[model samples]
Target: MAPQLTSLYTTSFLIALFVTLLVAACLRAINILPGRTCHSAKAPRKAAPATRILIVLGSGGHTHEMFHLLRDLDTSRYTQRTYIVSGGDAFSAQRAVEFEQTLEDRASETRNKATTVRRRGTERPLCVGAEHFNIATIPRARKIHQSLLTTPFTSLVTLVSAFSPLFRSDRLHPNLPPTTPYEIAAQDLPDLIITNGPATGVIVVLAALIAKFFNLKGCSSRSKCRTIYVESFARVKTLSLSAKLLAGVVDRFLVQWEELEGEGGYVGGHAEYWGILV
Candidate 1:
């Protein structure tokens, strides 16, 4: 009887091991498969005129982190940039205006002084009224520290409004024919999205993921609409509520604190611990 029991246990262990391996293999294949119902992951993508980027600004510290990150980004690599902020956030809008103009001026000086590119008369991005940049506002998902229950309804409403900017016509180009937001967003949706914790980040990130899932607004490709969520520097030992909620969905989840790096239940299995984004 003892021998029989040992043999049964061994057999069961082998079956479980085999099942686990098979499941892991299947999941790996699915992970590599890019989105788009009829799209081929192997197909070559056409490079657009310029790479578009969207940066979400959360009121105070988040805005500071983003501003520093934005300043360092190779502006030459990004032709157009968009800043997303919650409605009534005049501070964020003001920061964006000031920061974008600074960027423009810096790039212009580089161009004006360049012995190579300027010889070819390559035009620099204009500082004028932020033509190459836009400030998009969506209603706040819910006020800070509010109960989680009230959020679902507000979050749902915020989710729909989050997509509005992607569909909005560039009021700048009135001479251009009337264009649907989907068409415009599909053609020029951001290739990269950066954000720190906030209800605003949660909504926008979810919207981007949903858009990619449905292959709507041409942001279906992860390469075209990748989301990077950086946990707040203020978080020391544990993740903030916003980061915890977004950990499962965002493409890259970065934690500012090293101690919280190995928190359990992270959907990606691990979080990259990049010390202090600010």
Candidate 2:
């Protein structure tokens, strides 16, 4: 009697297992799987819209270097905007203006061409690389951590003057002292902010702080802008404490030549002599 009862229980368990499998197969056929097991035969989903991208460039060769990367950004996936912050004397303000203008012109031309093509009924898709790259110039503002006796009053005053111009975008009032650089940047916030190294680092820091404040106030999204430091002096094996700390905050870091790793160095856990620009 005991053997017979055990056999009956084993049969019931097997029947339950078979029923579960049958149900799963039926659900799959009907495309009603509860989880992610449903596999579509179509292509993968397209990337999210790149409505905004902020590119911050410091004075000197760094600006030129960052531009190279900016040029490569998949316009289909990004709307490139620019911010110019001079930290060093490598490029004069005039030169920076020229660079900024060149970028704007390129963006405009691309947009016009896309519109024209669409009007022509072309099959190619038009990618809006940068909806707007609002260019803002940020003057230098030194960061001074509060010490036992030192106050940040002076720094606060400096920032106020720098950011004051953000309020006056229509026209530089004749009264303002030639308009501080920070005022220009404050004119508008960005979706993503990118910065190169050396001079513009301070401006990047300030921009981040401002973004954080706006986010805390619930007006903007948490800092979606990314800062990219390319071929920075900090890339050297030894870096100042402050520089090291700054590196930690930057979103992505790129080095042209790795002296220790030499050409074909290992970066991003990938091996290549020449740094892949992406």
Best by lDDT: 1
Q: Write one digit per residue (lDDT tens) for candidate 1, span 1-278.
A: 35765665687788998999889766653553332321223457654445667888888778987787666666655656778889888999999989877887787777677756535555434332355678898888887797999988887888998887654424566667536432344246677778887678888888877676566755554456777778877788888888887766666677777888855234344467767766
Worst lDDT window (10 residues) for model 1?
32-41
Per-residue alpha-carbon lDDT of model 2 for 8-125, expressed as tens digits?
5687888998999899765543332111221123237654433344555554566666666666455444543445453344364445456556655665787788776745543323
Estimate TM-scores for all models.
0.72, 0.47
Span of 10 residues, lowest total lDDT, candidate 2: 263-272
Residue-pair clashes per candidate, as listed? 2, 13
Residue 70 local lDDT, model 1: 61
Give residue 119's error in model 1 in angstroms.
6.8
